[model samples]
Target: MARPQRFDTNQLLDAAVRLAAAAGPAAVTMSAVATEVGAPSGSVYHRFPRRTALLAEVWLRTVESFQQGYLETIEARADAREAGCAAARQVVAWSRAHPREAALLLYGAQDFARAEWSQEHIQRADRGNRRVHAALASLAAALGADGPQATERAVLAMVDLPLSLVRRHLRAGDPLPAHAEDLAEECTAALLGSLPMAPSVSGSRH
Candidate 1:
């Protein structure tokens, strides 16, 4: 049998993540990743034919990992308000657990040369976005809120707001405060509680 591979794909991607997190996406070149992992450049190319592909894979891997936990947390809650709050808290918790990946997430896909991504990569990104939006819509419906305004509120409560908290501390290279999760949950609860509840309709009398 042939000798086992030395540097696996995850090993290369981990190095890439470290580089991107420390110095931004511009630092995640093929040579850089190879040097970071102490692997031959051919090993990276063997796994990812091009830099664009590597960037796409790294971004997708991080995003999908985040989305999986987030979706699970929100879906597991029976109460709409609780679900929203849980999701917000999850963002803070996850960021605290994975600071390097969190730093990589601070930059938008565009910053990773998304425009040069392949159709498959674009589709993967779109699918993740659609799942997130769908989850937000479900949360809005369950909360008795409808229309675009309600969806916007759900997005703000469950995603944007929590991410903003993560972004601020991560950008400053500061560890998230101990109160981060509590703060996120409280803010989300407050926002969701503000939605105007749909009025109950009564049957007309004869």
Candidate 2:
């Protein structure tokens, strides 16, 4: 008889993500994950008791991946103004690369998920939002769109428009509509075009 095996949580989680990506979240079950990870069902149960918990974990992991990559993209921008534009473009690109994650997110981020959302998930989302907000704020300032305080409309306008358009492309199994650059430029211009160019902060050497 084979010895009872141990399951690595990371491995389990990784398998769960892949399963969900390939077969949708419904395909993620303890038995399914156990088979995918080559572990016993008992070992899988030792880690995740309920399907909801497992699904949530998978969704959370996807969210973390998105949050990390997203911030990195915006942070790479030379200025907030550029960050805004970059953010829009990055969002489209990210959506294309991770359609499964994006679909999972769209379903789970609805207001109804509040009842089941874990605090860790909430905190992670809040942190991600702050990064997004800050980047948007910076863009607004750079564009001279700041009115008394930060106007997030630019960020909202920029990302939301592109994301929705990209979502359509994913829905029909079609490629992302138009080149990323062309779509990004059109959205950025329409959203941030009104803001004045930031006056050069000359002599303010860090």
Candidate 3:
């Protein structure tokens, strides 16, 4: 009988991601992943002793890559205010472009039963989310959108608009049509317009 070869960590992880996307995380067992990747189950067990290890790797890979893109996009903006607006726009574009990745992250992150992550891993997750947050805060101040309350106003206002729109296009099983830009523009305008204008003239009479 021929001996079996071990699968590399990346290949196993890729299989895990694929399995999760297709059948959710429950399908990501060593046996299933090995079958998915055409390898022996022993190889997966050798690489990841516990199932949590594999899940963590999959979550970390997805979130970290996304965080990098968000950081780059936010940092590249010339104006903090524009950066904030662009951040919302970029999220819509990203969600539209990479809906599966978004879905996986949403599903993975929500499971509180997941393992305790490493400090470095936790920091990476924070860094990914904080890009949009910091940019939004800076932009809000720069554009007179808010002072301390982000969730009730700016964050709430912008996030759901794009997310809901993305969900609609996705559930319909259709690519974002060309006319989608019109909807995006209208959403962007409504969100930006709804922000409270700066306190009028600071010292002017009411």
Candidate 4:
């Protein structure tokens, strides 16, 4: 029987995530990840093939992990307004729980040399983005604010705003406050409340 592998793909990616979070994407070299995990460089190379693949995996894994929870949060609530608020709150809560991963996400994909990523990696990133946009569009329609402007507002209220809150604290290396979730939910509620309701269609009586 073959001996089980000691180091796996996720373990190496986790090390890369930590390296990127602590310094920047530039710090996530294959040798650096191998050293961080105390694994042989061959292990890292075997999994990633090159530094570009390693960087792509690091960014994609973190983002996919985050989006899974975020999408679930939005879907869990029956009420669109409440769902939007919960989604916002989830952002802060997730960041608080996974500060290192959150820090890594603070940098854009471009910072991870996204231009060098493979076609498969680019497709993976695009699919995640499309899923997020579709979810926000559904939320906007449920809230009776399905116009382009309203959908944009929904994205801001539920996604961008909460990320900004996390970004500030993560960039400063300060722990997110206990009230961060509440603050995020409150801000989302406010923005969602201000959306212009779509006009109702009525049948004319002959």
Candidate 5:
């Protein structure tokens, strides 16, 4: 039987994430990841062809993980207000659970050298973004948001506000308080509530 490989892809990526979180993307090197995990450089190279590829994988992995849970929260709720609040709460929950990965995400894609990314990487990022917009649009429709500013308002409530809450704690390297989730949910609800809902034909309340 063939000998099993000493290192797996996840191990390398996890190490890279730690480096990126602690010292930024520039700190994530092939040798550094190998050293971080005590693996041979050849093992790291086997999974990732270049430094850019390694960094890209690190970003893609972290973002996709976050998007998966956020999308699920939105999809499972029929009430737009409830779903929007849940989505906001999910941001804090995911960040608290994955502080290292979440910290890395605070660094913009440009910090990861998006200009050098492969077409596949670019496409994957675009797809994830499109999905987020679609989910937000659905929530906006359900919330009775109408008119030209509807989409913009939905994005601010569902994306910007919640992320700002999480980002404040993550950037400070502080643990999110027990009440942080509740605060995020409340803020999201309030923001969405402030927007004008579509006029009901029968003048029914939302």
Candidate 6:
């Protein structure tokens, strides 16, 4: 039987994530990841041909994992308001569970050097973007967000608010408080509640 490959792709990606989170994106070199994982540099190169590939995989993996649960949480709720609140909570919960990956995410995708990524990586990133937009659009429609302003407000309540809450703590290298998820859910509820109610149809009632 052939000897099993000692270093798996996930181990390299995990090392890259830790490097990026601790020392910023520039620290995520192929050699650095190999060193971090105590594997030969050839092992990393075998899995990822270049530094760009490594960075792209790390960023994409983290983002995809995060979006999976977020999309599910929002879609599973029958009520739009509840969906929005759940999405906010999901952000906090995912971050708390994956603080290192979350920290790297605080720097945004551009920091991953997307321009140097292969076309396949770029397309994967675009698909994730579209999925988020579609999910938000569905939530917006369900919430009676007819106008651009209304839709924008809905997006803010569900996306921006919760992201800002996590970004601040992650960027600062501070630990999120135990109540962070609750605070995010409460803030989401408040913002969603404050949105103007959709105008009623103008009709004579019997």
Q: Across residues 37-120, which tens digit of lDDT does each residue of candidate 2 receive?
A: 888888887877766666666776777787777678766766655666767777777777877776565555432244466777
lDDT string for model 1 (10-39, tens) is 999999999999999999999999999899
Off by over 4 Å in 5: 196-206
Candidate 3 lDDT trough over 10 residues, lowest sum: 197-206
TM-score of 1: 0.93
Clashing pairs in 6: none
TM-score of each: 0.93, 0.74, 0.74, 0.92, 0.92, 0.93
Give me the overall lDDT of model 6: 0.87
| Candidate 4 per-residue lDDT over residues 79-184, each given as its tens digit | 7777889999999998988999999989999998899999999999999999988887777777667678887888899999999999998888899999999999
- For model 3 the local lDDT of residue 53 reads 72
lDDT of each: 0.89, 0.68, 0.64, 0.88, 0.86, 0.87
**115-136 in candidate 6: lDDT tens per residue?**
8999999999999989999988
Model 2 Cα shift for residue 182 (angstroms): 3.0
Residue pairs with backbone overlap in model 3: none
On TM-score, the candidate that comes out on top is: 1
TM-score of 5: 0.92
- Between prediction 1 and prediction 2, which has the larger TM-score? 1
lDDT of 3 by residue, 30-80 (tens): 788899989877888888877777777788787776666666665676554
Residue 76 error for model 3, in Å?
Answer: 1.4
- In the order shown, the candidates' Cα RMSDs to the true structure are 4.7, 4.2, 6.0, 4.5, 3.3, 4.6
lDDT of 1 at 81: 75
Alpha-carbon shift of residue 56 in model 1 (angstroms): 0.4
lDDT-wise, the better of 3 and 6 is: 6
